[model samples]
Target: MNIAFQDSKDIDKEQVMKLYNDVGWYAYTKDASTLNNALRASLDVISAWDGEELVGLIRVVGDGLTILYIQDILVLNAYQNQGVATQLMEQVMQKYEHVRQKVLLTEEASDVRHFYEKNGFASCDKGSLVAFAKLEG
Candidate 1:
């Protein structure tokens, strides 16, 4: 598979929604405008494409100096387990290699934890750090 990566937020709204919905992230695809706006305001966005197909993406929202929060990362179902997500992450890591803190919050699943761990992320619970979040309903 020939995968190409791009560092930009100029992706098509339709393509972005299709990728999100394909991965079962209905919450994000519910409002196309809101989702597109969020992507436009992101600090950084890395996308993986198989020719013209949007296969994977990873976005961040932060100050880009002291801290960077990974907002979202998704790979299409057929593209999963094929290093697309890994390549996206590698790009993000390289872009923010000098940042002090790189963080993200994801569903508590063994495979999720393993994926992050394998990519050099450690559980805050395993250390003295603590994480908190507030969801809107």
Candidate 2:
């Protein structure tokens, strides 16, 4: 598979929505315009493409100095076992190599943990760090 990566946020909204939906992230896809706007506003966006297909993407939001929060990293189901997500993350890591803090919040699943761990992320509990979130009602 010939995969190309780009640091771009001007992706097609329909393609972004389709990718999110295919990954079962219906909550993000529910409001296409809002999702598109968020993507546009992100500090960084790295996307993977197999020929013309949008197979994976990783996005960040941060001040580009002290902290960089990985807002999203996803690969299409068919492309999961491949290194698409890893490549996307590598791009993010390389871009922010000097940043002190890199953070992400994701679902609690063994595979999810393993994936992030393999990519150099540590569990908050392991680091004695705490995380909290407030979901809108």
**Candidate that would win on lDDT:** 1
lDDT values for all models: 0.94, 0.93
Give the candidate number with the greatest TM-score: 1
Q: How many residue pairs clash (N, CA or C atoms closer than 3 angstroms) in each of the candidate models, in the order given?
A: 0, 0
Residue 67 error, candidate 2, Å: 0.6
User: In model 2, which residue pairs have backbone atoms overlapping below 3 Å?
Assistant: none
Cα lDDT over the full model 2: 0.93
User: How do all models score by TM-score?
Assistant: 0.98, 0.97
Model 1 regions more than 4 Å off: none
Q: Write the per-residue lDDT of candidate 1 for residues 9-128, one digit (tens) a residue.
A: 999988999999999999988899999999999999999999999999999999999999999999999999999999899899998999999999999999899999999999988988
Clashing pairs in 1: none
| TM-score of candidate 1 against the unseen true structure | 0.98
